[model samples]
Every structure is written in structure tokens, then in C-alpha cells.
Target: MRGPEARPRFGLSLRLLALTLVFVLLAEALVFLPAIGRARVVYLEQRLAEAHLALLALEATEDGMVDGDLQRRLLGHAGAVAMTAYQSGFFRLRLGPDMPPRVDAAYDLREVGLWPPVGDALMVLTRSQPRLIRVAGISPKDPRVAVEVTLPEAPLRRDLMRFARRLLGLSLIVSLIAGAVVYFSLARLLLKPLSRLVAAMRRFEAAPEDPGRLHTPSTARHEVGEAERTLARMQARVREGLIEHARLAGVGAAVARINHDLKGILTTARLESDRLEAQTRDRDPDLARTTEGIAQALDRAVALCAATLSYAGSELPSARPRRLAAHHELTLAAQRLHQAHPEIAVNLDCAVDTTLSADPDLLARSLDNLTHNAAQAGARHLTLAAHTSNHQTTLTIADDGPGLPQRARDNLFQPFAGSARNGGTGLGLPIARELTQAMNGHLNLHQTTPSGTTFHLTLPT
Candidate 1:
């Protein structure tokens, strides 16, 4: 249920500890069970061997077969301290009042071989008698006769049960201690890095720009180091972007102040041109031509000033779709170009019925910047053309001038970069590109050939 950022949320180290503990406990159980059984067997075999040797000694008496007197003497002595001496089963001697009482219910003895010399060749199980180990050997002088001993199993069973409980207790204590030590060691060595990473993230959220906070120190030389470096880089890039946005806001404010006064001057120029056109009409043809040219120049100046002001504005209005004549935007671009370079002649080439959905004012500004750039490259003739392709409309402005310089090509449409010509404010291409994109359109440099340069403006149908 927790997200990735949540701390100590069943991480890699804890999972590894859990898996390792299961295996360790299983292995201990395997060894502990078998080891307790083996210890009980070894002790039982030593006691049985000792009891059988005493019976053999008793057979050495003058009565060569079974010795009742020797048996009674041995039983009285050995049974007194059987449990303490063997730490296993009891010792018993037959043929005495103290010998195991005969039971009406008795079962035949079955020989169950304990591995190697550890236990007797046969043992007895009976409902009315105690469980037993049967030990027997031949008389030293008479091959026909045999000596025998019976050891009760109660003491051995009790001792083995006690030893098993102790062994299990020790194993439990040891495993718990080992698990705790391993857990602490892993928390320090492995989980420590993750803890530092969490603390660093907290600091980053609290006061990201504060240089007073120390960053997480990376000790690992593997992918952890790479992660630390990557986080630092991302923080740096974010900081730089914030600074750039602030700078752009300031620039916008300053341009807005300058545009107010420039608009007033443009208004005065338009009024003067209107008066000149009224006087030169019909009476002097040559003078009227010159007056019209002055009016066109003034109009271009006003439009150029407006475009610069629009660039300084925070946002421009959306394009209003209307019936746009083919030559309207081109005429505006040519008039604006004449204000800066009157010698250049701009020609419009089309089938004359082309139309596009766009804001004429914004499109003219875009084309004016392009034509002015071409003129500055020593272009003597400029061409503006309109065409349609695959449900889209395109406007192209080209010139027979030098191509764009190599240095500015990469960032030609980015802000503050494409100012290779004199009297060029670098924002022109960038603003043009921005406005074009806002209209759901695109502006691209179609070519930079030796004979001329071309720019393409494409708008969706």
C-alpha cells in the first residue's frame, strides 16, 4: 500500500535476512536431531560393553557354565550404582532375588543391530517386563557354554531425553543471537545509505535553494554514486530554468515601457502622410506617386512597431479565421521591407486564388522579419509565393541572397540566437516561430541555397 518514497518499507536487506534465517534454522534442526540420537547411542554402547565384560569374568569360576553365586554378588554391587556409572541404561545380573521378576507375559527377544559396536545384538520388548539390552559372550575354557548380562533401558532413556532438551535450548539461544547480530550489521552497512537518501530528500523539499544544507554523501562506488550525481544534475537544471524565467519577465516589462512612446511617434507619422496624400492627388501625377510611396513607408513603420510591441506582450490573441486574399500578407511584408531596404524589389508569385485561415497582422510580422533578413544578405530581388499541399496551406518568402551563416544555423529559431544581420533584434525569428506554433502551424527554413534563401510557413487545413 505504500509508495516508493516511503521509508523502511520492507526493503532488500530485510527480505534477505528473512530468507537466510529460514535456511539457518532448518540446517540446525537437521544436525541437532541426529546429533542427540548419536550421543545417546555412544553412551549406551559403552555401558553395555562394561556390563558384558563383568559377566565374562564371573564365568571364569570353577562352575564353568552359569554362576548363580557370582551373578547374585555382581547384581547386588552393580545395581547399586548403575545409573550414575553409565549415564545411560541400568545394569542387571540374573539369578538373584533382586533380578528382574519373571512376568507371565513375555515376548521373544529380537536382535536389532545398532551401527557398529555401539549397542547389543538383541533387545527384548515385553508388556510385563522392563525394556532391555541383552549382552552375551562365550566362556573362556568351554566353547559350549555362554555368559549373559541384561541392562535396563530406563536410565538411558531419561538421560537422552534430558540431553535433547538441553541441546534444543542451546540451539535456540545461539540462533536468536546470530539472527540479531546479522540484522544489526545489515541495517548499518546496507540500509544506512537508504536512510541518508531519505534525509536528503526531506532537506531538498524543505529549502531547496539553501546552500547551508549538506547533501547525502555517497560512499558506494556502484550505481548509488551514479544516482547521487543524477539527482544533483536535475536540481541544477531546475534552478537554472527558474532563473531564466525571471530574466524573461524583466525583459518583457522593459519592452512594454519602450513600446508606449514608439506608438505615439508612429501615430504622428501616419497623420502627416494623410495630409501629403490629400495635396498630391490628381494635380501632380509624379508627386502623387512619391506621396503614395511615403504613405506606404509610414504604414510599414507602424506595422513594424506594432510587431515589436506584440513580441513584448505576455500573450497574443488567437488567429481569427476569415477570407484572406493571396497577396494581402505579402503586400504588408513588402511595404515593411521597403522601410529598411527601399532598393529591394519584392515580387508575389501565385495562381491568385489562394486563401488561408490566419491572423493577417501576425502573419505579416512573421513575413516582414524574413524578408528584412533576406535583404540584409545583399538580396536584390525577393519573391513571395503561396501554395497548397495535402490539405494544408504554405507561404514561402525567398531571396536571391547569401544563405544564413553556419554559426547561427543550429539555434536559428531559438530566442536570442539568430542575429547575424545588422539592426536585427534576435527575438524576431523566435517570436515568429512562437506565433506560428500558436496558430496550430509551423515555420521552417526551407532552404539556404547560394542563389537565394527560402522560409516556409505551413498551416493545417
Candidate 2:
């Protein structure tokens, strides 16, 4: 649903829902966990303390334990049965076996003072029915005879469950209220801006030319500001690109119409040059050679005009790849360049004396553009060279000129985008590069220095 001139689209509702879920989950966990811990701790502590007091109440006699009433009271308090078992001179009282399964045996025994204090927390075997005895003195009246009391755990379980439910309910309510408050606060502060951005996007979708603005609230230098700026820049660039594309399509159509008239003009020039050649019969070889060169130059000019027309109209030019003389093409390009700019000197170096299987006319045109670029860049001298290595042929054009600026170098082959140079149409490099590539060759900027720049073209041998 994205288009040019659209504003920043923000997903505030999704973000709010996500944040609400997270906060609700966190609050629920927090209350649920601590409440459970506190309930367990309070139950265990009370049970243990009561067990210690119960053991103290029983008195031991010579015959057996006394004060049965105290033992029953201790059992009731402990929610568990107390047992007495005698062995030798000592009498022991241990906590009852078989507690409720819901009650943790570990927590229950830990609450009672009967549990031992050692390296590890003493675990009372509530399940293992053990017998314990309360020892008495060597007298019948002594309240030290062993006695048993069964502790009921049902009351403790009921109380604990009720307390747990109440705590759970309270915690749930608090969690929901807190989550709602957090969600609303976030919605007002953060989501409001996003909602506005979304509304702006909707307006833009309705009418692209007059898209709504996405003004960011200056609250914090967070991701929100960065996102706003990025969206704005992207929208502006896309809008400009669409407009530029429309203009180019129109220009392409207009150029197609003009190309026909321009071709006719070049054809007239060709006929005139041919007539001049037919009339000229010089006795001097130098004059003949000069006339021949002029004739050849005019032919090249016509060829270039045709190529330019093809380029403007986006027409693909035909290629005739064959074993052609490299020196001839180089000479023709250099001579044509010289005619164009007599001030600049041209030099040729043929390191590899071989013919290349490529379109000579296209290659020459590529070289012509490179030379013109160098001249335009203020080059005093130009050198054209050819080399062969590993079954590949390479042609290099070097210029003793002020090198291309960084901006131009980065996008050297992009059309209609000039670097720092004034009055540059920025199509020469692109056209040259396109022609070279169409001929199954590659073009690249070999190197650039303060003294000059060099362009390299490669074709398969």
C-alpha cells in the first residue's frame, strides 16, 4: 500500500497490544509467585513453632509420659499427629507421618522444631510412619510416660487454599489494572504520534500529490525521530524519481521523432563529402592523403550521428564482430578527436600487434567519448594503448588532465547526473560504457590521480 508522496505509516495498535501483553504477563507472574511464597512461608513457620511448644508441654515420668491434654492440644496446633517411642533411657517424640499431598513434606517438617539442624535442612519423613517416645523419670507420678497424638492436616490445608485463592484474586485484579494503566500511558505518549503518522499515510494514499506531513513530536532523541526522518527522505526521493521517470519517457518519444530528421541531415553531408572526394585529383600525395582523411572523418561523423540517434531513442545498434585491424580504429579515433580538439595532443601505443574480434565502429565511438571526456576534464594530452594478456584484449585511454572528482568517480556511468564539472550533461560515460558492454566487452575506470585519469576497456580475445 506504499506509493510516492506517502507519509510515515506507523503500527501503533500492534505495538500497544504487544506492550500490554508483556506487562500483563509480568505483573501476573510477579504477584502470583511472591504470594505463593509468602503463604507457604507463613504456614510452615507457624507449624514449626507450634511443634516446638507442643514438645515442651509433655512431661516424662518413670512409668510413662503424662499430661495427655497438652499432647492433644499440641497435635491440634501442629495439624499433624505426635508419636512417642522409647528406646534405652531416652524417650523421643517425632512428628506424625502421612501429611496432605498438597502440603509439601519439606515445608511442613521445616516449620516444626523437631527437624534437625545440620549441614542439610533436615527432612522429616512424614510418609514413613516412625514411632517416638517421651522419656520419664524413675517414678510413677512423673509426667514423662510416652503418649501419642494424631495431628489433623485437613484444617491447615483448607485455610491455606482459601488464603491462596484470595491472594490470587487480588493479585489478578491489581495486575490487570496496572497493565491497563501502562497501556493507556504508552498509547497516549508513543502511540499517539504513530497514529497521527498512520492517518497522514491514509491521506497520502487518497491523494498522492498533496500527501499529509508527518511532523515528529520533539520529545526525545529516540528511534521515533530517526524513523520519521528516514520516511520523509524516502518519500521525497520516490516522488522525485517518479517525476523524473515520466519526463524521461516523454523525452525518449521526442528524440525518436528528431532522430529521423538528423539522420537525413547526416546523409546529405555524406553525399557532399563523397562528391568532394570524386572531384579532388591532387598530384601531391600529402594532399591526397589529407583529403582521404577528411573523407574518412566525415564518414565517422555520420556514423557517430547515427549512434547518437540510436542512443537517444533507446535503439540497439547492430554489432559486426570480426578480426579487424586494431591500429586502424585507434588511428581513426585519434584523428577524429584531434579534429574536434586541435589544442589537445593524441598519442597511440600498440603493445600487442594483433587484430581484435569486435565491432570496430562501436569501439571507435567508445574511444571517442572517452577522449572527449578527458578533454572536457581539462586534459592537455591523451594516450591510447592496447594490450593482450591471457586470451583477453584490453584497451586503455590515459589523459594528462585534472582527474575526475570523487563524486563523478562514484557515479561516473550514471546518466544525467553530473559531478562537480560545469555544463556536463553526464551522458558520455554512460553511453560509452553501454556501447562497450553491448559489444561483449567491459568498461571500467582503471585509475585516477591528481595528474590525470585512465579508463580501461576489455574484450574477450
lDDT of each: 0.64, 0.64
Which ranges of candidate 2 are over 4 A from the true structure? 1-19, 54-70, 83-156, 199-208, 211-226, 237-252, 281-301, 315-428, 431-446, 449-461
The positional error of residue 420 in candidate 2, measured at the CA in angstroms, is: 16
Candidate 1 local Cα displacement, residue 145, angstroms:
25
Per-residue CA lDDT of model 2 for 260-296, tens digit only, reads 6776876787677666666665545566566677777
Best by TM-score: 2
For model 1 the local lDDT of residue 454 reads 86
Q: 1-461 in candidate 1: lDDT tens per residue? A: 23345555787777868966776678778767566646655554455445445545544656533556665565554431221112123333323344444332221122323342223211211123446544444323333434343455555566666776787788888777777787778687666666666667677666656554436456568665666766666666665676677797888778767776777887797788778778878788788788788777767666656766766665754676555766666777788888889999888886666777777777776777777777777899999888988867898888898778775677798655676664455677787777787777899998887787788988764
Quote the positional error of residue 353 for candidate 2 in Å: 30
TM-score of every prediction relative to native: 0.40, 0.53
